[model samples]
Target: MDPSMEHLLARKKSSRSSSRTRSSSASSQTPSDQKPREEKSAPYRDPRYETLLNTKGVFLDTCDLDIAVESKNIPETLLQGNQTVPESTIFGEHQFEYACRNLQGRNEARIIQDISRLLVPSAETFAMLGSKHLEKVIESVNEGWNNCIPLTGTRPQPDYSVGFRREAFSNEQLDKLSPFIGNWLSGDLSFFMATYYMYFPFLSCEVKCGAAALDVADRQNAHSMAVAVRAIVELFRLVKREGELQRQILSFSVSHDHRMVRIYGYYPVIDGKDTKYYRHPIYTFDFTTLNGKEKWTAYHFTKNVYDNWMPSHFKKICSAVDQLPSHLDFGVDPLAETGLSQELESLSTAASSDIPLNPAEQQVATPDSSLCGVGAAKRPKKDVCGIASDCSRSVTVNHCASCLNQINAHPASFNIFASRPLR
Candidate 1:
């Protein structure tokens, strides 16, 4: 019998027992020639039954069922109910609970399956997004910061110094900026920070140091850098199409010894194409740290243009990464080309050959001990029929030994083994 059917049968049996117990306690008084007592004297039944009856319009001022039926909203009514009859009561709570539980389980299973199917593709999409952001940052730096300006002992020097301080925007003021400008920059920045912090919490201080280095006294250079940053931010905003324009500089510090300036800030990101902004977790990493410790490095900005916009651009990449689906399994049919059916057929044929034919064939073959061969030497005389022996009854059949050994030898091969059992 189907497991589901068995479960339903068990539920029905339990419900019937409960119903019998409930009915057994009712008064056995019979109607007689005498007039009935006052209406209030009627025995009270379960409130749940009253609720169900009321819900069915059998005993209430209003009911969803009556509205649906009278309005011809529903094509059919599967349940029948009346006020006095227990079996006629509609909408049993126990049954509804059971159905809800079952439906919830099914929905959870489907969601898990969908996530598994999406995992790898989502990861690849995120990687591509990161690559595009990186490329844009590189382009911005090359176009905006090809020449260096002198910062120390300057006499009517260049307009911008590499390590000078520039004005910074506050969260409230940043929000008041142009929507496109603010959202594009701030959202991307938030995403970058979230990704960084999730992977490298210790790099928070270094990030502030790097951003501080970009603070310049030269307004022209600062404007140019901002423009470059804006362009990259717009690219990501256009693609994601969601997220907030809010920005908050968590901290900012300068480090002349390392020729680095760092700033830590929070920005939102486009979670998907529809939602405007989603605030991701925090992140922190330094571009200068990547120069020598390449392996430990989280991100790289080859040119100063990228360096200026790094915080926001990395936010886009991180958003893409976070949005990735957690699990995936492409619908590649393992049985289609696995040849498992043919292998099973061969095994079945071999097992069948051990079974004795009719009486005539058994008499002709007669108990040939020598023909059993060395492989069967250890077998008992009555069990020399090879596959004819009921392996289920054997104490040492080693049903999973060979498969387990193969899995141990080549771990990657487990995918195939796992697929086989599923088939």
Candidate 2:
């Protein structure tokens, strides 16, 4: 039943007490019904929680996240052939060729293997994730991925780092980091989104492995998109130093439940007028449902995210140095919103700073100091009028301009502060 309807039913049930009291004094009432019932009447519980009562010695329960259709149901698989690439999608023409590239001929298998390693390293998945036990799985692959991808000639080489639950992130920055339903910004590993010289990130990802991962993929996916959208906006705001936070992102949440792997993608809308920040999700798959080429396509997309690299040939760059690209191919359209207030608040803070919108020139302001001692830890600076930084006159003691001018008028009077003993 709908949650609202359930709440309405609960309200009506509570009001039934007055009617029950009135019925007790009815014209024909049974003696058995006169007595009050047991006070320990148990409340209703959701059936999903009922699994706890029927558990055995060592039990494993799971909810499958894969598309429910059986393999034999359709002749042409949705995830396999040309149908996988939508006409309006942002992907290039040759998906497999892009993902499975090698120095010489082919290494599609290498990309797939690397993606597998990224999502789940060895047998340990989210067991130690989010806790302090072990670092997130993405941290393990950062260096390898940073080295494997060829340096892009169009832009400087990137130095992507897998930062895990970093405390250095500003509260403003942390707040805007996602589409996550609950708290997700503080923990888990995330890759920086910028290329070589830049520091801010344009993309980020979250990974979950094994059966439990599939159970939480929807939740994790929502959280990942939120972060990606805001991070993209912040990155653009820093670069342009303008009102538009129009950077695009390529973010994903990868989940490998047992043998099947599900990859999710997110992209920001291209139009500057449309401030939605992110679009509907576009997703692909590997493992069972997809064939060789299809699996390669998924792997290539993963590699792209790992490298902070997007294929923008024959189009403008997304780095803001060039014209904005038409769109980006992030994956499936997710059922989530970007929570724009985080970005708005971040921008508002920048706007509220000392820099005025109409100023033709700017000046740095300093505070006046009342301190007058050499050995003090925080000796007050003598910024008489705001000219302390540029003023050349040496000040040995705190003195007004009138006294200093009176001393300077007589050259011999300067000897009073020339480290001489008082006579």
Best by TM-score: 2
- lDDT by residue (1-423, candidate 1, tens digit) is 112111111000122322343354336422111112221112212234334322322221222222212223111110111111123111133342343233232332242232211111121233255634333221110111211111111101111112211112234422322221211111111111111011101111110112322232111222222222222233334334333332311111111112222222222222243211111122223322433222111222112222333455445434533433332122223323544444445443544544322211111111111111112212232211111122322111122222222222233423432222322
Report the Cα lDDT for candidate 1: 0.23
Cα lDDT listed for each candidate: 0.23, 0.28
In candidate 2, stretches whose alpha carbon ends up further than 4 angstroms from where it belongs are: 1-115, 118-212, 237-249, 269-279, 284-286, 289-297, 304-423
Displacement of the residue 257 alpha carbon in candidate 2, Å: 2.6
Top candidate (lDDT): 2
